[model samples]
Target: MPAKSEAQQMAAGAALAAKRGEKKVSELEGASKQMYESMDEKELEKMASTSQKDKPTHNRKS
Candidate 1:
């Protein structure tokens, strides 16, 4: 199979982060909720990149 293009990967990552953020807002108890709610895609992508840098990789992981 072909690999995901950078744009596709970034978009998918941002979408996943946003969904996670929404769940976080409902699940977190305090300031963390507000923090996630306030983050835009650019910030979310940065956060996701930093958070995933050292993680293991696989086709299904992303």
Candidate 2:
């Protein structure tokens, strides 16, 4: 699924980087860390690729 907000997309991007070894998983924290652990590359790619235009910085619901 696509990211619901800019923050979610950012977190997914971080996680995707770690998944691809572009960034260390140790560099992740909070939602990014969780995503790295729980999501696969494709799922993260979908979320990270979601356009941030007109989206909120953060989703209100957890």
Candidate 3:
């Protein structure tokens, strides 16, 4: 929807990646690392998916 929300979604995805061992917590920075450490796999997945569903749409003004 909004830029802020999109960034949050990206952070959640990064958290999920860390959980899956695709990335390290140390590799992530700032809020992303904090979010990853604060959430479990299920929670991260849920948040990521929810954000994906809320992605902004580009509608042409025809």
What's each prediction's TM-score? 0.33, 0.95, 0.70
- The TM-score of candidate 2 is 0.95
lDDT of 2 by residue, 1-62 (tens): 99999999999999999999999989999999999999999999999999999999988975
Backbone clashes in model 1, listed as residue pairs: none
Report residue 52 deviation for candidate 1 (angstroms): 7.0
Measured on C-alpha atoms, candidate 3 has an lDDT of 0.72
Candidate 3: which stretches are off by over 4 Å?
Answer: 1-4, 51-62
- Between candidates 1 and 3, the TM-score winner: 3
Report the number of the highest-TM-score candidate.
2
Question: lDDT (CA) for every model shown?
Answer: 0.44, 0.96, 0.72
Residues 31-52 of candidate 1: C-alpha lDDT, one tens digit per residue: 3344356656565556445443
In model 1, the runs with Cα more than 4 Å from the true position are: 1-24, 51-62
- 1 or 3: which has the higher lDDT? 3
Give the Cα error of residue 27 in candidate 2, in Å. Answer: 0.6
Q: After the best TM-score superposition of candidate 2, give how far the Cα of residue 57 lies from its true spot, in angstroms.
A: 0.6
Evaluate residue 9 in candidate 3 and report its C-alpha lDDT on the 0 to 100 scale. Answer: 73
